[model samples]
Target: GNATMGSGVDKHALERSSYEVLTGAADIRDAITKAEQAGYDLLPANADLTAAEVELLQMPQRERRLREALNSINGRYDYILIDCPPSLNMLTLNALVAAQSVIIPMQCEYYALEGLTALVSTIEDVRDNLNPFLKIEGLLRTMYDPRNRLAGDVTAQLSKHFGDKLYRTVIPRNIRLAEAPSHGQPALVYDKASRGAKAYLALAGEMLRREEMASAGA
Candidate 1:
């Protein structure tokens, strides 16, 4: 319906809160503290940070702002996730430096494959010069529709290239998943019976199973 949901967050609030913390007007802290869970933790995108990028350019070890902010709150969470803005910007470098592993979510399309090549190259550069701990953990195929032949072709190509690094679970394109965000909720909370919700649940299970296997193998 695209109607306004009463409980949705204000963009200005996120902008204000983020600017205060990021610029040290308030406290320097992990971006996680800025989130409001809509079923999963999400540090809402702060547009003000785009300006911070320029401010960072003149500073020493500028790429380490996010990494340093997060370090103070270490061991608070088993996993810390950052969704990067597209492009190899200063902010993206900060996340790569802070992360232990990278998960690349790709759409089953030729353009997305091309993007992966660029992302892989960037990851390699970060590993070589910035963050040695960073490595590809998984490549998740998103917005998948089996009816599309192009999708199948791209999936096959990804399998051939990535092999074991690609996750088996695919996130299918479903209306419920799309609709959930407008209502300020996760698909599972908005429509637990929906295919999108079920697929996510399956993905969660696969993630846990793989984590256990990795620990055993390690």
Candidate 2:
């Protein structure tokens, strides 16, 4: 099993290297870049479902693996961030089934409100159809630009609608964030003084405060 997993990563590495290391291209810009290099276009790498993965549900083996993976991670960490494939497939469904909370990272933009409705609907669907315990942990404002009038309007709307569910910390757009992944590290490791790094640190502290309050309540 580990061999299979290792090979998969090696395949991706070769795919990524084919452009960056060998051909000396842009080193696969984003997640989409790497997916395109692997000979698949329009691949749902973000947690969106496809037809095939849903069909595989007929096999009990798939379900067993899902359950096992979920059970394995329980209580092993304080937080398990499941970056689901950008599709509503079996994997996404399994993640929804397992996770008790969902943290949506969103940018403050004019059309961002339109996107939140879809995500909120999906969470509602998951709660109604699969995971009853699942609730939105919060909506984190990412790549925030306070100078943008649209951003301010969107943030105000979010605050009005979700109140405390809108985190006070807003992550500003920063080059350091764009640079860190190239070195295979978080922005904190790459540039502690960067605005993005400081924002994330503030988010962490806010989350910790919530955790403390929850523990006290318990």
Candidate 3:
């Protein structure tokens, strides 16, 4: 999941929170903050966002609230990534409804397959019921260790099952990537030369290349 706020945020510029925007108490624009170092605009969230899960349950068109909020700024961004909590809930449903596609990142662990199965089922349901355009963009393997036999086995299985949908770039386990969140910064800003940072850069390049190929095919 993406960090809610980067270290570059100017506290003085803050006005509204993601909770307020999701709950209809504030406009999405009011919750947006510029993270100059990260080179992206962020709608920062906090613990208060948890309350929105309950509050949204009582509201009409709860699953569509986020989609409605983001429509106003749809033309401003080329990509809008919504990082949902690691669970199936109203928040995740809202994200599914709002997104065009999903990038699923997972570790090469035994339990990860089970989780992926459940997540895929959820996405299929969402696609069928809520968003017809919703699809799985790709599966990203993260924290991969080449020396681990289990990891290699899982990766091979994933490749066999997912084929081209599994990204070629794998994010190796690195200390810098793990520490970046504590510093409220990305691995690229923390240590651009680190293996983790380089892997992520490669992933970005891969994604761009895929998009170009897709466009060409289209």
Q: lDDT tens digits, residues 1-218, model 3?
A: 24654445544345777788989999998778877788898888777778999999999999999999999898999888888888999999999999999999999999999999999999999999999999999999998999999988998898898899999999999999888877778678989999999999999999999999999999
Residue-level error in angstroms, candidate 3, position 57: 0.5
Number of clashing pairs per prediction, in order = 0, 13, 0
lDDT of 1 by residue, 1-218 (tens): 01112124445455334445445554444433322434344344445667877887877787877787777778866776676777788878888998999988888888898899999999999999989999999899889999999998998898898898888999999998888877776566788899888988998799889899999999
lDDT of 2 by residue, 1-218 (tens): 12112112222333332112112232223222222222222111211224336444655554234434446436644564555554456666666777888888888876767878887888899899776898988889999888889888898899899988988888999988887755544466668899888998999899889879889999
lDDT of each: 0.74, 0.61, 0.88
Position 200, candidate 2: lDDT = 88
- A best-first ranking of the candidates according to their TM-score comes to 3, 1, 2
TM-score per prediction, in order, is 0.86, 0.70, 0.95
lDDT of 1 at 67: 81
